[model samples]
Target: MTSRNTRHHTVLAAAIATATAAALMGTALTASAAPRPTAGSGRPAAAPVALSAAARTGLLRTARAGLARTAEDIGLGAKEKLVVKDVVKDADGTVHTRYERTYEGLPVLGGDLVVHTSESGRTEGVTRASKATLKLATLTPRIAATTAQKQALGLAKDKGSAKATTDRAPRKVVWAAGGKPVLAYETVIGGFQDDGTPSRLHVVTDAATGKKLFQYQSIETGVGNTLYSGKVDLATAHSGSSYTLTDDTRGGHKTYDLDHKQDGTGTLFSQDNDTWGDGKTTNAATAGADAAYGAQATWDFYKDTFGRSGIKNDGKAAYSRVHYGNAYVNAFWDDSCFCMTYGDGTNDSDPLTSLDVAGHEMSHGVTSNTAGLEYSGESGGLNEATSDIMGTGVEFAANNSADPGDYLIGEKIDINGDGKPLRYMDKPSKDGGSADYWTSSVGGEDVHYSSGVANHFFYLLAEGSGAKTIGGVDYDSPTKDGSTVTGIGRAKALQIWYKALTSYFTSTTDYADARKGTLSAATDLYGADSAEYKAVEAAWTGVDVH
Candidate 1:
């Protein structure tokens, strides 16, 4: 984690400037270029292979175990019905798996839940399944990219003829991090070629060592401009929004609103040659800045804490658009883009573009991309709590000289219409009707407020019981048992939360389930009997969750 003093505004300002300028031309710029085909340009054919009966049964068992573990880490209960319907094996012995399950009795089905098992029968990898494969086999892409290298190549934008004359070829290789190989690529885009071609060379690198592995010219696709928009759609598919309408009320500036010309929900506004949050904004500049900061913060939080990068560990960059619509009152994460949006408050004065709010909103993307948490009841509370935890982690990561880390959300955005933070972790009830602890009735309330129990637990896990100052804010968090619970600090706490989120939680997580997830995650990160583990267990107890 970055120190508060060294980070904060400078890093945020840099991210904003970079993101805003990067968005001006609407082109993709990756760290590397795609590797050219070493063999034939024509599509390759797959060789047929077959699996034995024993192999089939073994693979199915492995898949079931992987699904169970994933569900457990994601806060989905053990009884959520992780059932494997069929398992098919190809000539290479690679397996295609399908399953049917229910989250609180909601029938759900998915496929291609790939699992790699070692000789000892221990699961090695569990990749996310494609919805199309799970929903309809015919809908799956015929040439779907499978490996990390293929995925990285698929993510880059076409650079056109400018890259054709590139004397430099992109390097390609797998970089090792935490014992796993990560595919990395690097390249320049939008630059002039020797012949003045309107393209740039893509460079690929080893994600672990930053080593250049390969380089290649991106094939120009005239539809390049639509690529980002398409990616945005793919990222936000799970998020319930139809379109992103820019807010141009004041001038040419914009706010990425939900629909074209929709009123009442637009988030930020532009004013006085500057972007301020007053419920409406003109462009994605300032809100983009806040979004960039929050995105980077959450990204860094996961990476530095748990050794993961971006949302997919694939070196993917987050997309953020500002100035949503006229007088919008909220910001949101559209799963289709794996990006977040901000809004100026009603009438365009208070933009919900604060760093904490940005983190809060962006975390939703992270959660969606990871656990696919359901958005109702106990699971909903866990989903909300996950956002709050990561949002606080972002503040802590900023280590900003101006805005420090604390238990408050939206302190800078002034969401309350007063000079106060939106929500308080120390005394969550400060949010008017937020619950302070777990109760049966809590599930019936709003997901945000009912999330207090988990939020309070996270705060206590990071800061312990005491009156202290952090990032210029004062907090005197208490314990339900009145027993001092020594925490593992914010950095480690954030790590545990993220691990639990990506590895342990499901859409049905509640307070008690959260307690188990963090504890298990702590044990996994540290040792089962380590101080960190004990602290996590105690922290939940302190919040009356254990």
Candidate 2:
């Protein structure tokens, strides 16, 4: 169900430090005064905070109350009802709480804002994603719901069943795509597409005119069974004589079975004893083990490498659901449920739950919470690339013996059943669908294929151009201009990428912006004139991103 248009992500900080007394004293700040620069524009830098364990707990406990007062202090209209979505407490005790707005009881799609608070319980600044006022002409739509549903169905790519089904009535929402709020009908169309892909299309149409405004498929497809990564240690909880598949060490991440259903969590994996599974798909526990291991490894990679507490950076682990749907051939990260779902492959023999696939899926959650790169155009490609890059990083970080790290993605999963990997980083175009270099039309390509540009840039930045060998795998990366770029090593490359993603890149950021962001990140981590910074610049140039 993954589409090029889906969008969501974690937080990126933009600090505006004005005296707290001024804000408390009722100083008027216009909406434009809120931090709204594209992520990585390098304005209003965020200040890191360090808070003790006890202080962090206390701050979270009072965050909701503070949000209400802060909303008023920040000039929010009385009608704007802000619902807190996430709260992040930095090490320095600065808390950034994300909020979604609703007007007259209808959800405001683009009116998300974040309120920053200091350790002393004072408002520091606010970062708003939408500057549009949420005043609509009317809540009731002139277009009938039936007509809207018909329009939505007409626009759907998959009209498998002459009539698409919806779970509920079309909801009224404020469409804010062009930075102005418009009364619209948000419709969900569920069915199978012409290409056999599952569809959970979310369509937004103008309520007054019935004109289509926006649409994106909600089903994210990306998974596995008998333990793909081989024998691995698992953290389990024992209650009486049965053990559950919950990892206490990694934020209590649990694995569940969807039992061939497309909706709801099926069952928590449990057994009578510690002995989990044989190396075969017949045993469901085997698939659960692989999923659990993947989550654990990915969690450890983020924590140990980037110092991120977890996927949300709040030390809260996202659970994993395996065996989702019947003979399904994909895996996805759903931010709404805050969990990862993996489907049993075409025949249930190849569950798409390999390490890299798991890493890739979970990284989507990371991207959703960070830059939230819009899943379309160049930004979408970068979003997919972020997942691939981080997934590869997790693989390398794990250094697992059975499934050793390689630049190839999903190599062991046999996703195509042809013994060929899903993608190759060194020569991305080798797959026949990916672009080896960037072009003006690159944004028009599928996100998975267009991701090659950034993937290539990362490869060149980390391992340089031309032939090389690492971890028993061979790679020959080519540059656009046939120039030989020197390596900055993967460690430094990962640091720059992570920093750029979390601190700089925004939803609308493109390839050019990515180049600038990585450079800024490199400058922050290394000297502006350091070799690592130079390498980053050269790598982007090598990918024709300049």
Scored by lDDT, the top model is 2
Task: List candidate 2 stretches off by more than 4 Å.
Answer: 1-142, 156-163, 179-181, 191-199, 223-226
Alpha-carbon lDDT, every model = 0.47, 0.70
Task: Give lDDT: candidate 2, residue 101.
Answer: 70
For each candidate, what TM-score against the reference? 0.54, 0.79
Return the top candidate by TM-score. Answer: 2
Clashes of each: 86, 24
For each candidate in turn, give its C-alpha RMSD to the true structure in angstroms: 21.3, 7.9
TM-score of 2: 0.79
How many clashes does the backbone of model 1 have?
Answer: 86
Worst 10 residues of 1 by lDDT: 13-22
